[model samples]
Target: MRHRHQAAPQQAPWPHRVKRQHCRGLADEADVPPAISQDWRSFRAALVAGSRQARGGEQSESNQTLLHLQDPVLGREAVWAHSIPDAEQGGLLLATRQAPEVLMNDGLEQAVVFLASHGPEGSLGLLLNK
Candidate 1:
């Protein structure tokens, strides 16, 4: 009896290598969900509005900036202990990026002073008074 050699199995092509046509009409087709389309439209509108607002100076600090603080230490004892400058005693001071100043209370307890920036949803603050 003669022995017959079997052919090797063919390998499948990679999915990444498959060619696809641009579905230009798919965007207009009613097959797309209404909610998905609405979401896309809203996203596009927001992007455009943001770009326009940015260009129109609506995002400037004078227009969009606000200050916030928590647990403020005030009065003569707090001031003397912290060694805060006389001029800045009762005023809000902008926090420096470098080493933040340490603030102390009459009880000799220490706290960090901070300047806060607030937005519509949230706020960020830097400790400047401690």
Candidate 2:
């Protein structure tokens, strides 16, 4: 029941937040069936979608849920490096998040910090500036 967002801290750089744990989660989820885990492509799309959404976790998450798509291509780039090993990719630049604001935990009225997650409580993000 462990999650990648567990590494996310309220205050941490985006790079550090994108630890191996996140990649490992992505890799692990890739193996499971869609019934158990979300499809890799759909998951990535949700992240980059242009609307706020809840992250995949418990069924009853509050507004603290983390997910908001801004750009699918950018999220695709960012996720590719983590989900797929370099050996499989055969040498490519690391994918990075180019947008400033990312996933939101709640409605637009809620505060959204695109820096990190709630550390074991929710998702974390890499700094858009960094």
Candidate 3:
């Protein structure tokens, strides 16, 4: 059966509980697709052999541009860990691409979010689907 519903957690946080439901048959730490299940021994061997992929600029490079919020609430926004957002700590996060006049449909984008933590800057959470 498809695990589309959140399962009872064995000490999981609320968000992870939700993710567990979302990634159901697609992926998991110990669960592999049925097609690959039969050849897992070979798969494991190949994975070990090809591990530590060849390093290069293309493989090591990544970039991120912070999106700003227009009408951010005070003290509740997710800020990039390296900098302080105008929201301070608890405001809403808005992506630069989101148009203020656009009618958001079914939380289709990461245009808005709340900062759930302060130190170590945990995950960037968007309560769209939920």
Candidate 4:
């Protein structure tokens, strides 16, 4: 007589990465569990908290990562938009006039770029709607 073979235990998938893949249109939610979703939310909150700390005095009650720049011309409320540090791969980058430096040599004012890569190594994106 021979013994039956046993399968190894399955490992849990990373909810954060899975959610990103979903946003990138690379994965479906059908296979995800509810617990994973909750875990993702917790993880996101932690990240947002860290972002707030990283920005030093800026604070936001909402989950959106925002940056407010003072108007140089009119000297009024200038621009309020998502911070560049929040950019991710496969995400869209909207060039803002308040940006510290010119985004591109061709002029990124009111331009959009597709983020191909984003990380500590730096970023690379494709210009769009030129």
Return the top candidate by lDDT: 4
Looking at candidate 4, the ten consecutive residues that score lowest on lDDT are 63-72
* Each candidate structure's count of clashing pairs: 10, 6, 7, 0
TM per model? 0.17, 0.18, 0.22, 0.35
Roughly what TM-score does model 2 have, to 2 decimal places? Answer: 0.18
Q: Candidate 1 lDDT, tens digit per residue, 28-111? A: 437667865767646545655666665662333431222112222322121111222322323334433332334322422333
Ordering by lDDT: 4, 3, 1, 2
Q: Which residue runs does candidate 2 get wrong by more than 4 Å?
A: 1-12, 19-27, 36-116, 120-130
Which is better, 2 or 3, measured by TM-score? 3
Stretches of model 3 off by over 4 angstroms after superposition: 1-88, 98-110, 128-130
- Point out where model 1 deviates above 4 Å: 1-36, 57-130
Displacement of residue 80 (Cα, Å) in model 2 is: 26
Clashing pairs in 4: none
Which candidate, 1 or 2, would have the higher TM-score against the true structure? 2
- Alpha-carbon shift of residue 31 in model 1 (angstroms): 15
| Per-residue lDDT value at 80 in model 1 | 15
* TM-score ranking, best first: 4, 3, 2, 1
**Top candidate by TM-score:** 4
